[model samples]
Target: MSERVLIPRNRGFLFLDSHPAGCERLVTDMWQACPGSADMPEGDGPVALIIGSSAGYGLAATLAGLKRAGIRGIMVSFEKAPTERRTGTAGWYRTAATADIARAAGRDLVFLNGDAFSDTMKNQVADLIEQRFGGRLDYLIYSVAAPRRTDPATGTTYASVLKPIGRANRTKTLVFDGEGVPEVREVETGPAEGDDVEQTVAVMGGTDWERWIDQLVGRGLLADGFATAALSYIGSPLTAAIYRQGTIGTAKAHLEATARSLNERLGRTVGGRAVTSVNGAAVTQSSTAIPGIALYTGLLRGVLGEDLVPPVHQLAALWDQLTGAAPSDLDDEGRIRLDTWELTDDVQAAVAERWEAATTDSIADLADLAWFRSEVQRLYGFSVPGIDYAAAVATDIPWPDHTA
Candidate 1:
């Protein structure tokens, strides 16, 4: 096994082997909170399909569906397999670990590894639903985060940009040195160009989500009263210039618009509904890639205190919304605001105050950078409790038979 090393100053961790015990602990927590858990609502869970289900919110939703909602899951993701040089992406290990646990409990889970944006992957999932889950899925969860997307028809690839929409915004960005010491630097991001908005939208917007729904409907893979949700995020005003009002935000707006259209169409056609879910920020592989988000997350978590919800807890809240245990609290645009707690007036106010006062010297005291760093490591199956990090393990574990 390759040696596991932590990047300096809390950037992240690197290793070739996943901690089996860590994976088990993570999934076990998810399972214990699942539908059958004492706190969950009782009912027969729906048959569900999730795109981008290997990591982040998608993984949480998948686990919530299986454990809390008691549903059979069909998960799709684009992830690397284990190779001689490195272990597979954390999602690969997570899926494998979760599958073993689910099967032991007599649950059904299917993981399809490939590009979810392609027609080929969509068709494969449709077929799998028919073959394995008796032809219909009750829930479709779209939680993919990609930097670029290839158009299925024209084969043109569009990449997403993370620039502000107007003039450049310079702000104090934080980074950890190789030794784990925090340093603050002023980072400037320029405005988006003429085609940047369009390109970003084309890559990250709801176009593919709509296509997936349309194809599934056309193929009769959706059950009556089916529901679909795609994840989005709206940050606080502190980072609005770069995040909420930026190029990616334009794409998110398009996504919400598509959700509105799909909701009406699905309601009219199949008595189903579709909605966009605005989720709270958390540490994930995707979010870590976005500039300024890490600092924002740390500040937000510090302000929110223990009330902050992680991805798993957020998915639990979503399950509550879907199962009618909790109210949907639909916005005027017909979207669901799962970030309700995070966006509370008190929380934003506190974060805003810290945002203004934050500096290299003050950040460590004002924000939860410790928590942020630990979570980043956790995402990669590192720094987890109960794992013998020194143990020798194989990098190339075979995919479960169902996934294979």
Candidate 2:
């Protein structure tokens, strides 16, 4: 086995083979957090179809659906295959590990690897549902994060930008060197221009999500009284400029509007519900790449302390919300509030104090840099407990029969 080194790029860590033990540990943690089968309502649980179900919140929801509700599922993702010189992405291994666990428990799992935005992929999923699962899906979860998207109708490509809307906003950013030391540097981003917001919306907004729902309904793949949701976030004020009030924010605003339209359409057409769940901020591969978010996450962890929630925990909460066991907790706009605790007054006050005091010298004391770094490492399937780092693991693992 060659020496495994953590390479820090501007975005996030790049690594080779995943620690199989770590992958297994992730599955174990998810199950431990899951609701038991007996706790669920009587019946073979709902049939769930998850888009972008390879990593981050999407993957967590997939695990939660199977373990918590005993639901059969189909996952759609776009990931690379392993090569002789390199291992596949961490998501590939995570999915493989999850499939093994689900199969052992007698749960049905199907994985589709392709561009979810393409028409071909949509047709394939609809056909598979018709042939395999009796042509009816009860749930749909959309959680895709991509830098660029190619429109299937026009074949035009649009890219998402992470700039503030009106003016150049100056802020401090933390850049890690893969050695646990982070340097704080002042950075500034110019405003978006020249249809930048439009492009971002075209790529990351709710159009693709609405399209998926429409296609599924048109093919009669969605069962009556089905439910659908797409993930969104409204973070702390510190990140509002670049995130919530920026180009991405414009896209999100559009997404929220679409959710309202979808709710009405789903309710009338299939006696179903559609919602956009506002989630808490967590360290994800995409979040780490944003300009000011890493610094904000470190401070948030410092203030929230043990109250900080990971993706798995958030998914568990979502399960409880979706199952009608608890209150739906809808806000004035009719969007679900899964992030209410994160946006509390006391938590924001402490984060604000630390945000002002944050600097290169004060970061070590004011922010939870260690926790942030560990989460980033975990995203790449490293820094996990009980993993033999020196083992010569096979790079290419076969996909499950259903997915293959």
Candidate 3:
């Protein structure tokens, strides 16, 4: 006889509202919904800041680092979907949920509803640091994943053009159109070379990351012994053309190189180090969108859950390194081989080989399919516990009281 709970934001769609307070409540709800065991452990001296702490792997990074490393710091994100004029965006709810969780834990959490790529938001974060917490941060995470960006000065738009590296590379990916597993065929390779590569780099590359660091340091807001890191990925050669060697790959290369440069600059003031983490492929919203990623992720998920650690766990290990408990050798060129344990040379080679041999007539492991389905569902905020799904809920949201 319970009433149904009505979520403010629509399910399965990315939405945003300008209200920061409601967004914070949504975040709290999300945190409560997650299984308690899902939280990573926090070591001593937990002080961290997470940029782009909203969805996908970015949210995982925030939770893992905070729970494991004990970093109870602020979170900043640039979610441009819902405004007060257009309430009930996914970000607004996510922010609301985040605030609730932080309050319960006696931790500090701040959600900035502006463009992370802009100097204005950066300035706001700087001012907040000065006014509230004495301008000191131990750990900084750069985990923004956007498909496009516009040059504030030139007014030119840059986007990540999904393309193949060399010639037209055709491959078979998983087709989930049906309830059963099927192999789908793709052709015409991907985006053309030259301009495609440059455009992709411009859109997804390291410029924004560099600017963030610059703003924090320039404002004298960064604390001593600061450590910063960004996430990256490298999949098998099947989609290498479209992923690693393609447009997105070029941007990642830029990011990898930029980390070293930023580390050197930050070394002077904060004696800080820049790290690049090669995260595992989880069933995140972004991963689902990438071409040829679902099948690989699905097959690897079951295998990883058995033998290897998950991406969240990998994040926890990385947090240990950031806090000086673990050695840097745990990572590679700022890239942590999170999937290496599960996707061992033997494991990955086997998956690639099986995928090549797999035909539409072939039957995949039923268990793998089920795991994939569950993971995808978990990504969308479904299957969450605690809240009464059938309870009558009000759609009205409380307005945010952002100081800035």
Candidate 4:
């Protein structure tokens, strides 16, 4: 392998490249940030699988499961591999770093790279479970985020849209030029046209999750007492027009409905269950691309301050819930409400006030804009504090030991 210096460059709001050492630093930082499972009443024989276990909440949940639960784990994600001319995805580096840490610690972990929405990927994971997990899985997490999905039955590709449902959406948003300061502007988006909501649901919703469950059940891959969680987000009213009550929200509603249906079916058939873990907002690849989400999350961080529950912490707590340490804080809809901190009366009042008064000059004061930008870069392994960007490091880190 050849070594090269990684200089971070921003293409629009996304990073053009990722640093391997920086990604390793980030994984190490997350390992330290997560709560240890020393006091928890943990159950044994946990063979866990995270469907989108390379970045964002999936990666966080994977870390929580590994460090706290010490379970045999399998990860599934789709990311481009690195070539001689360019670095691969941040997820590729993150997964490589995760595998490195797991190996050093003697942890049981596996990684598979492929389109998770496809039946082929499901079959491959089933085969892995049979070969590596004694033919049964105890825990499953559905946390995939994608721009589009091709239906296996019909081979129709559906692309998700982030538009409002009923009326035009006009909201305050930020545009980063990768310079000294960001420009805050008003963005107007039209409502979802014909088939937009359906397409969004097909890409971002829970049909794939249900399909995974059905396929695993059909193969007898899920163990008795199996539990699965699908991560969901119902954003604040600040971005509600474009998020919670919009096309994406419609898709999330479908996801919640699928969870309810799957929960009942799993309970009836295998004495198992499924639930949607409604998590707090954080800087993730999926959330950063949404128009108004940047402004909303910045204000959320500003108002909540130290009180804000980071996504990894929320996921670690979810692990505690799944492993019998704590009971779930479920809502009337039977969904685990991990977003209570973000939805509190005081927090919302402050965030709304900040949102209303925000402008190009005042937005930074109203929200942690610098931190938000840093976080976005950190996701792609660029803005990590300790990594030496000037030093040359190997970019072609091989994928973890697993079938791709």
The clash count for each model shown is: 6, 0, 39, 0
Better of 1 and 4 by TM-score: 4
Off by over 4 Å in 2: 1-21, 35-43
Tens digits of per-residue lDDT for model 2 on 231-274?
99989898899899999989999889999999999899889888
By the lDDT metric, which is better: model 1 or model 2? 2
Please give the lDDT score at residue 246 for candidate 2.
95
Report the Cα RMSD per candidate: 2.7, 2.4, 4.8, 1.9
lDDT of 4 by residue, 236-305 (tens): 8888888889988988999999999999999998898899999998989899888888888888988877
lDDT for model 3, on a 0 to 1 scale? 0.64
Candidate with top TM-score is 4
**Better model by lDDT: candidate 1 vs candidate 4:** 4
Which residue ranges in model 3 land beyond 4 Å of their true spot? 1-47, 80-91, 178-183, 330-334, 384-404
Shift of residue 134 alpha carbon in model 3, Å:
0.7
CA lDDT of each prediction against the hidden true structure: 0.80, 0.81, 0.64, 0.87
Scored against the true structure, residue 341 in model 4 reaches a CA lDDT of 86
RMSD of 1: 2.7
- Minimum summed lDDT over a 10-residue window in model 4 is located at 37-46
